[model samples]
Target: MRMGFTGMTLDRADHLRRDEQALKLARMHPSARFLLLDGLKPVLAPDADRLLWVRRSQAPDNPSIFLGLDEEGIPHFALAGAAADVGGIATDARAAGTRLSAPEAGIVALARSLLDWHDRHGFCAACGAPTRPVKGGYGRQCDRCTAQHFPRVDPVVIMLAEKDGLALVGRQPGFPAGFFSALAGFVEPGESLEEAVARELWEEAGVRARSVRYVASQPWPFPSSLMIGALATADSHALSPDFEELEEARWVSREECAAALRGDGDWSAPPPLAIAHWLLRAWVEGQVPPS
Candidate 1:
């Protein structure tokens, strides 16, 4: 039951990563696998369905990110920047899920997040000095002021609020028509996950959640976010969506949600790769409390 990007079995031994020579050895591993990103898009094999993992000799001089080692101690790496016309293969990161294996999907997510982090955080915030990758891509070090920085991961609360036999779903204004998903919002400063879930439900759909429970988490790498999946029991079953953020918000029955997840219903739920779809599936399958 591993989610798309949750089962990355690689050992990211960050504590033991000070040896730069070890990183060099990993890069030069005879059996090392490498993936390249042209900007944020992954370069794919021309005639294959998966990422084109090139050899050490074939990889670019500098990879934008370093993915840690697998169980076999074989290292994985990624090059970010522009898609090189390497062996006539290329594909956008968004399409990686459809063609790549689940583990590779996790690797792609890591690469994408690191790419966005490096792109946005080229300068240190503490002293506004230029920073370079250090500790095998685990973080950045500013040459001036000697400030160290780690990558940023934004926490987002995504929830399914249910009452009676129905769960609430909301559609953003710009989503494909009829498409709806669990209510989600970025956690504001100084808010707990439960508080964020409650606040988002209230702000977006005017639903007051009396209680909420954690479900799971997923790495949403479209510019780097960690989706905290949750389930909430509403204080009342009511609907008054804030039009600014939602085109429509309403309670959908369990049967309807079940069909939506299966792609058989007219309503469009989030895709299978998204955590929202799993949240909806959990609700329709009676995993929520008060059963």
Candidate 2:
């Protein structure tokens, strides 16, 4: 299945990013289009899943972030600053995902991630100096120290632990009642993916992971994260919910998990937009162990 935010069709033309003249010419292209966003929410068509785009003349005067060239070589740009009254419905990331197509979602994810990063990192981290966008919004250069900064994506491990046909699911305090999803944690420095998975499983639910196998990945742009989906074999079925991490944790059978995936049971798995849903579904379909 095509995961959400995975199939971006843009050329990303890394070569043009560094060429000031090329980028300027692309922006001046007759077919150049600009995507509008109100803060982090993307403006969409009022009645469809389509992203609402406008010509450069209609976009804000603020500097625009060059997204990339589309299949037809048409330059596409996203507003670097929040748009005030660009007529259209602006929706949050989750709603936008359901409304937009995969390619559109991928575009939105990239735009949002880059825009957010720029907003937070307006100054040099090494020295107290103002930074300016360079390389067509791909990097920032400190004005005083000449320090260079680029967009960073934090790695996260989201995994499902399985044992004896039962998978371990957990719920955070903020989760809706009866909603349980795969356990996840950010991949820390110097930790391997497998080690992160095992450590998170053990720390959150007291479930030790015997072995971990790669499943799939998703670009979660809720402030930019690459979720590495994995499947692990649990050494034991014991439940130990760490209030600090999870409000509750338990093991559920394949049947129960399927029901949750179908939204037919008392509890529901993560929404289809989440990688956790795919990870759990993969396990329920018996595709993880790989015979």
lDDT of 1 by residue, 113-143 (tens): 8877888888999999899988878789999
Clashes of each: 3, 0
Question: Model 2, 131-184: lDDT tens per residue?
Answer: 999999999999898899999999999998888888899999999888899999
Model 1 whole-model lDDT (C-alpha atoms): 0.82
Off by more than 4 A, model 2: 80-84, 289-291
Which pairs, if any, clash in model 1?
38-82, 38-83, 39-81
Scored by lDDT, the top model is: 2
In candidate 1, what residue range of length 10 has the lowest lDDT sum?
81-90
